[model samples]
Target: MPKPATENLIEFLSNIPFFSEVTKSSLKHLTTVLERETFRKNKLVFEKGSVGEYMYIILSGSVKVHEKNHVFGHMHAGECFGEYALIDSNKRSASITTLEETHVLKIYREHFFQLISNDIGFSQGILSVLIKRHRNIDIIQENLASSKKALELANSKLSGLIDGAMDAIIMFDEKFRILLTNPSASVLFENNDVIQRNLLLFLDESSANRIQNLIKNDLNNDQPLSSNYLPDVIKVIGSHETETLNEGTISKWGDNVTSFYTLILRNIQDRLQAEDKIEFLTSQTEYLKEEIKELTSDHGIIAEDKSMKKVLQLVNKVASTNATVLINGETGTGKELVARAIHQLSDRKDKPLIRINCGAIPTNLIESELFGHEKGAFTGATATRKGRFLLADKGTIFLDEIGELPLELQPKLLRVIQEGEFDPVGSSETIKVDVRIIAATHRDLLQHVQDKKFREDLFYRLNVFPITVPPLRDRGNDICLIADHMIAEFSRELNRPINQLSKEDKAALINYNWPGNVRELQNLIERAIIISQNNSISWQSIIPQGGIEQEATTLQTSNTIYTAPELIEIEKANIERALKRTKWKISGENGAAKLLKLPPTTLASRIKALGIERPI
Candidate 1:
């Protein structure tokens, strides 16, 4: 018998997406036709191929929709089903089973038709449900087909990979029963039938026991295991040969119910043989490089400091590549030496390495020097000469003090760096050169970029692999090493017998903060060699009294410390002296700009900012 529906049922149905547009009056009549029903767990609500009678709307609990024994989907409260059965006379396409005690509102075919007749919205709702069901079914079918195709492709590739593999691949169940074996795995078993056989039958007793324990541990693990039991070497007994396997590992596979352990083995005999040959070749190459380095003065680089060692390591890495390298450090910090090391370690070692000091060249002659001028192109123009770029063709160009390069020349440099082509001074022909550029600068190029002095694009281009060489103060004991080398050279140059540094001499050298870096140390060592009568060098005689320690001592002894005004007074005096040397001329050759290595406009701005004026 069927129960009567309630007004609450019609109110709930009105909220459903399919029936939300229907009038309240129409929904109220629908409640009179819908009978509220309840079914117990494991009860069959409908069977496949059964006659179509009513559509069900779940009010509570859950229902399992399936075909045969295969479950397709489930419906909980607030969901509707079987609307398709009401419109057609065909049998039910899927059976509905209750998973738990469920409450439902059922509308029989005759009453459903009555509700539709009063309101056409009911008919459209039924049609909407039918269309949606068909579309969902199509999507599921398409996904199933696509998934099947993907699975087939993956399986085909896996089969090809296993068959073509040279490594032995064996898969066994938790019980150690061999489930499958590739051709490589089977070969080790003397072509015997391996499937369904005990894995211990083929492997050595010790190896088999170890592998058995590993598999048991993996099975007992509750968390997801990626892999386990990586063996350095595993000996496996084969028909013709006893195979020594390297990189052997046992990995987990499949699900918990039908879990498997896959054993993968690789033979590294050929790889080891090749590694030995490579090691021998590398040693011979290093020996030749060392011999060449011993013949040079700086040996390209000395890097005893940790920071400098890291810089050298980076240089070795980037040297192989064609990327532009920018070395940054304080003046006399061996930035140029680092650049030279990169070139020496590179493939361009056989070619010339033309050096250019941007700050050394006069502003007026810089363009002509970088891109050679034609004969008679400018005053005192010499015969046709190749520029630094042309001379460095098929090699490298070490651009020292790169931050001093003029703004006007930066674009041309950028063009040449990016395109490997440049136009010479007073010439239209574009000259191309394959030159590796290694630029070094003591100035903060980034600050220059902020001041609009250096091009940002050019900075990025040169900074592809930036290496910062540590200053001598940071190099600690490396100062002694550098001093020793300098002593030998200076002794040879001066015809002196200075061979060693005394304890006091070494302590003085180490104690001072080398503001002038390695160059200052070399100068001191050279002076010491010349003044010393005995074999040992004198520290106090050569070393200056106005270094970092002297400044500290002076400050400590003074009653009053100097302020900003005093420092400014000193700067003002220096500027005035430079002005006098150039006769108040701020630009052009022998002018204040050229003397200070500052642009004319920059010098003018500084003069205005500092309230500097020429003497009457």
Candidate 2:
């Protein structure tokens, strides 16, 4: 036999200080008019200066009484606020904000007046509660006055430290309105009139939002007030809209009656600029180191033969102009060397000569390698990277094996050549670079276009000024000239003291068909120098026994005219012989592919097409 819900509510209301002297009937009537409302933490129940029509009693949780961003006192469950509103209609003197998720019961001023007029006990109960609240408010005002005095003294002492600090310091209220600033802050902002202005007015939108959210989160969580440095540099707009980068810390502090935030900031523009300069210098130093290494290894171009001299002449002719040069040659036939020569002789010689082998890079990554990618563009792409084309800005980019560039990426490459701009991987923003492109490839691009493997438009664009480099076999007497130079270079490197190639070695080198071209010759000379005895390199020591002579004899002895099909058969037979000699190995120093002076990929393709397979 429990009481009904209405009776229980009436009993509960009677226990409250506001209803303690009220009659049971008046208390029951009061419960009928009481409206229940729930508020989230940090939600405003009522604002100072707003019209107050209801007095609210907290049913659960707590709230803070504040005025103009200053927390004066706290009200807990079973306590009431806005009581003055029920008595005499006036604007709220203080704001009530929930400290946690709160439930409150509010009574309308009309209902309160009606209750007071009809019931003497109800009126007496209301009078008693108002008198008690008035006394408590007087005590609280006295305590606030004393706290304000102490706070002023503390601020006076803190002002000295804040003013003396080199970093700009500013104090702000909850609304981000500047309350105080030190001399350094005025100097930093380049304005003495920053006080009372919103701090967000001086910051960019992103920075402003970030700071607002940070402060609001801290306040809502009731976290301990402490100073901590912001994670990144913020862009600040100073007087006359001048922008500057600044790093700073924000701190929250309060006396019992009021809370405030302080900002400590330092300008980092000059430091960042100096760091950028240092980084640039470091990058330039590394580039110079690579250039020096290249110079030491190969002493420029040794072009004694007419064909090579003609190629150098073309390089010199086009070097001064900003023209796209297409170099056509077999693999290892000094195409990259010609590209380097073009870059060195041009005005961009002082800049970089960035080189990338298009065929060497994986098909999946070739696009990113050439055009770069944004951070998080793909899996494991943790940071933004500048591409080869971007790095070659105002310089030259040598794209070796251009024929192998993927068909999907060809249009982008064409755009760079035509419009001087491209978009990076996973980015819509287009980047323009004033880079001169020099493309080289062993494969016939025209054939590729005809076969629909390469775009005709892109091929035509790249073939603007074509230069053909003769293979090492066709370079004629340049072999001896290059050999002598390499011998001298390698002699110094290995400390072998071998300075000359024997007459027989020179003859054999000239007679051999260097399918791998200059690269193979360079490797041979270096190996010969490494194993040379008595300051002399013999043809026998470098080549397998009678291998060069047998190949030379076969070529010299072949006088029969052959059809296209017969020629293909002969070429296939020759490759099969070489592969068998090398035990079917296709790559590396002693591999048949290297011996035949062909790229392993090219040899593998030929083997597959010729239906050649390793014997079990």
Best by TM-score: 2
Give, for candidate 2, the lowest lDDT window spanning 10 residues. Answer: 546-555
Best by lDDT: 2
Tens-place lDDT per residue, model 1, 498-568, is 75777776767777777567765764565566556667644644454333222223343664544444644
Alpha carbon lDDT of residue 539, candidate 2?
Answer: 64
Residue 36, model 1, lDDT: 85
Cα TM-score per model:
0.43, 0.62
lDDT of the structure predicted as candidate 1: 0.75
lDDT of each: 0.75, 0.81
